[model samples]
Target: MKFLIVFVALFALALAAPSDKDTVIVEQNSEVLPDGYTANLKLSDGTDIESSGKLEKAGTDEEALEVQGKYTYADPEGKVHTINYRAGVDGFQPQGEDIPVAPVA
Candidate 1:
């Protein structure tokens, strides 16, 4: 009888534990320009430019970006470009709406 009681208690505890597989994480990145803000500019032919930002989130797959910064991009040829961007919670929903919860036999 004691053994049976212990087994049931352990089973209940296991069920109460949170499942890591059900959790999700999200990340984002952005960049800012030195100037106040700039508009679109044409880049010189055969020139390439790149910029980067950072983001970090946990607890849910959804990411909510309350604000975003402005950034500028300039090509090697000295062509200038500017852009303003913002982000928010996006692409966050359960893969399946009707996941079955099976009873522990």
Candidate 2:
């Protein structure tokens, strides 16, 4: 019936609609290099994620990215964790608590 078809179409559209509850929410206010940004995402299954990044330079008048600063959130076994990382010509270096990693054999 026509009513049945309309109902099915509406249902399909609702399911396909974009929703933050089911997808990650991005919060960036930068449009150029050497800018900072942060992101907060909530998963459908009740997971909270927070991250941030920014560009840094050794000195002014620098052209390209040299050192990258970053931070991320991790929840391991219901324990909250914070991680900080940096990357450049040297290499990507990460420093944080060992709580995220379990004892390795």
RMSD of 1: 23.3
lDDT of 2 by residue, 7-97 (tens): 3335333433464335443332322233544434443333333334444553555522333333343343556455455544556566678
Q: Superpose all Cα atoms of candidate 2 onto the true structure and report the RMSD in Å to 1 decimal.
A: 14.7
Where does candidate 1 stray beyond 4 Å? 1-63, 90-105
Task: State the weakest 10-residue window (summed lDDT) of model 1.
Answer: 35-44
TM-score of each predicted structure versus truth? 0.25, 0.39
Each model's C-alpha lDDT? 0.31, 0.41
